[model samples]
Target: KSTVINALEDLSFYCMENLPFDLIESALDHLTREKNGPQRFAIGIDARDKRFVKEFKNLTEKLRKKFRLDVLFLSSSDEVLAERFSTTRRKHPLLDVGGELIAAIQHEINLMQPIELAADASFDTTLWSPHYLARKAEERYSGADLHRKLQVTVVSFGFKHGMLKPADTIFDVRFLRNPYFDPNLKHRTGLEPEVAAYVFEDPATDIFMEKIVDLHSFLLPAYYLEGKHYFRIGIGCTGGKHRSVALAERLVKDLAAKKIPNVELSVSHRDVMIGQGI
Candidate 1:
């Protein structure tokens, strides 16, 4: 369970481990009001909390109505659990004074029945490695990128609006040709064909794309091997209406190439519609 929670944190979820069930709704309200809180969240509930186990269904039903939820119940065999506690030389949470290890394991399993039965998914981890379990947890929540290992977020923003927020890397397409100066293309965004054509038509953009593609082709796989969960790339321009947006699209296309395996790609034009009636 700790491994899974850590994996969710690596995926940029704001995680609360061993969170008491009673405070969950109020905690979510607090997260919503924070100036820069995470939109994604993962909460770990302790089965040892008797009230939580007794009220699991009601609390989860309330949570589901207000927020999207998935409950993952993780357990191992009694023998394996007993061995783990013995190896760690630690007392079991359910163990009574001078109680037997196997007995405590069995008792906890019985206590966890209500939760395991109600969970969205349940996994028996007697033979599973922590790495394998963490990977499984990441894959379960990472969306349709089952075949990929890294998530890449490419966002285009205007320096005029603000510096791109907390990206892993940023590229200034401000050096590329500006479509804002063109009378006809001035009102258009890079999503339009003419603006995209004008931006990509620049010889400098072709060289820039080549260098970027070369750099990330190596960087993406290196980061994946380093066990990175996600990468954010920011593309900035003087005004996000044109050049940055166009190059961002082109970069997404280049990133989709077969050479970049196990990479999930997505792009956002952050300030594209700021001045427009969007």
Candidate 2:
């Protein structure tokens, strides 16, 4: 809980950990009274705190009456939780009560049942990477900023490697001239100036990119207005090293140049190093 609070503090959120249930109201009052108090705050409580867990609903109601609050509950399958404990070699809080690791996990899960039922939102972290989980948490708690913002993740992938999942939009750049055919560019990636020039210099490539940009420019705003929070755009080619990477880069640049308000862009070349030796 201290670790989580520290991380939130680093992100500029005023944080408190393990405030007793009885003091929550006073804590809020004190925070709001400070001249330099943070507009955003995070309070962390362990699920193992049975007293707090039992009173969570009432506490949540009281807090909601005073401020906009969100309850984010994170959990994972038993197997995943066990694996995490194994990898970290950390003792579970329930282990202090005298039980095996799996038994401790089950005990904790049982204790958290009521809180889970009362959560405003819940996430299963079984398959999520740490970075992905952090990104998701930030996005979820961004509050009012989410109303005006749309996150765009542009991914460049290779057809041979497999399709990217969870893509809101996908563009195939295979029809564009292949840079792999040129021995000079075969070993180079689209990030290289020579490879990028080769991929984008074709008239057909220009027309394709223009069409894609036009479509996205038209659709992105509509999606945002319709309450879409995140958009994933996948660009694919025979191999992710060249055409897809160049086009994804160009698309991100064009989107940024538009200066579309509240739109954040991120790009990744998923298969850029598929054949490169680690």
Q: Pairs clashing in candidate 2?
A: none
- lDDT for each residue of candidate 2 in 1-278, tens digit (9 for 90 to 100): 34445556667788887677788788888888999877778887765677787887788777776776766677888899899889988878778764788888888888888888877678788898776777677665555553557899899999888888989999888888988889888888988889899988899998998898889888887666544678999999987888999989989999888887668998999999982311
Model 1 misplaced regions, further than 4 Å: 143-278
Each model's lDDT comes to 0.82, 0.80
Report the lDDT tens digits of candidate 1 across residue range 165-237: 8898899887777787788988999989999999988899999999988888888876675446689999988
The C-alpha TM-scores of every prediction are 0.50, 0.50
Q: How much does candidate 1 score in TM-score?
A: 0.50
